[model samples]
Target: MIRSFAVAAIMAAIMAAIAAPVAAGPIEDAIAGSWRKPADKARDQYRHPAQTLKFLGVKPGQTVVEVSPGGGWYTEILAPAMKGNGKYVAGLANPLASVNAAKSVENFKTKYADKAIYGDIGIGTFGKGVADIVEPGSADVVLTFRNVHNWHMSGWDQEAFNAFFKALKPGGTLGVVEHRLPEGRPDADMKKSGYMKVSYVKMLAEKAGFKLAGSSEVNANPKDTKDYADGVWTLPPTFAKGDVDRAKFAAIGESDRMTLKFVKPK
Candidate 1:
């Protein structure tokens, strides 16, 4: 009877081992998954989605909000990463407010329709002093990518920062990735250049009640002189100059960007 019990225990252990789920691979696997478009995948070398997300402390099962997904560049990766286990809120510009914004919303819906990987994403409208789009104090993480310059230009940076502050839980995080201007560049110069001063961004967030958590150089490109003729748009992707020095800019890759992480103090 003792020998029989030992054999049964061994069998149970083998079955348990077989039933266990496989350990997950690195986050890069999710970014490189088959669901991504080839063009979007190509940009990963510069964007560093895996490293960036890791820095933001994004984990499965957290509630994340992305402000102004704008063609869903990050959405392409975020939607899938959050599928099944987490929540993703997309705070968009009100479509009725702008023809371009209307098109952006339509494109986003069309692209993800019937695609289970996107899961059930929440949609909200933000901008122009309007903050009702996202539920206040409900988000675990709020992220914006290269978008602060637009708000700065529109004279709504403070309002937008305040909205972000309201949207996050007390302990939640705000992650920003924006084109970085050289230190001491005046705010007036930033209006048209699409590059923002790091100090200025931190000031705006601090003014809205957030504390600077940390900053990362993961996305920095020292090759960018921050003095492009057409500003950051002169870099690869946009190449605003249109082949004026395509090879030169392409060699430099994307603009140097600041990756900042801020938190709503608990």
Candidate 2:
């Protein structure tokens, strides 16, 4: 009877192990960091920082360049994750590009100057025929989050992709997370709405000499009806419509995002 009880206890322990949540790794640790604002933490439900980084293949010791890191949301996680072993380069428009772009980069640097939290982050440049964001073939990973639409609006989408392609090492990764337009939508909608077509984005990258590697729905939202009055800004974070249908947008959450990976041939 004692042996029978012992066997049952062992089986129970094994089952418990299987049921346990995944142990926090470096990326997870960075996402759970105390330095991140509560507001930023709340977005993790939609952002899925840990899973997104894993999909992008961001690893320690890699030279990671984040293009147009608006508000430094990912910077908060990446800086700490890369503090000791790697570099975090923030690629924004060069200070000479425009007043707003210059101020934005300045504000970002001032906001993230804390070495204890953000490490020694570097600055790189793109846009406005400003040239490379980093040295040719220097970066292991180049990530752009939801900023592609702005480039499209600027009519420099091709230039931006060319810059990204130039910045990456051969066999390196270019990870893009952008608001997605449905396949059936008119291509012109991309210019009006903030969302873009996967095919169009792929064409841009391919024009810049990148081969598609993979794509993920980790940030997909089926509830986004994609016909908002103010485009994607009509959603929760922007709530462009003010109180009108705020609850409806809140329930819908963030826009559906396409998480794509492209590779520079070795």
Evaluated at residue 20, the lDDT of candidate 2 is: 98
Candidate 1's TM-score: 0.88
What is candidate 2's lDDT per residue for 142-209, written digit by digit as tens? 99999999999889999999999899999999999999999899998999899999999999999999
Per-residue accuracy of model 1 over 53-99 as CA lDDT, tens digit each: 99999877888899988878888778777878788789987888889
What is candidate 1's local distance difference test score? 0.88
Estimate the TM-score of every prediction: 0.88, 0.91
TM accuracy, model 2: 0.91
List residue ranges in candidate 2 displaced over 4 A: 1-23
**Cα shift from native, residue 160, model 2 (Å):** 0.3
Q: Give lDDT: candidate 1, residue 16.
A: 100
Clash count of each predicted structure: 0, 0
- After superposition, the stretches of candidate 1 with alpha carbons farther than 4 Å from their true spots are 1-27
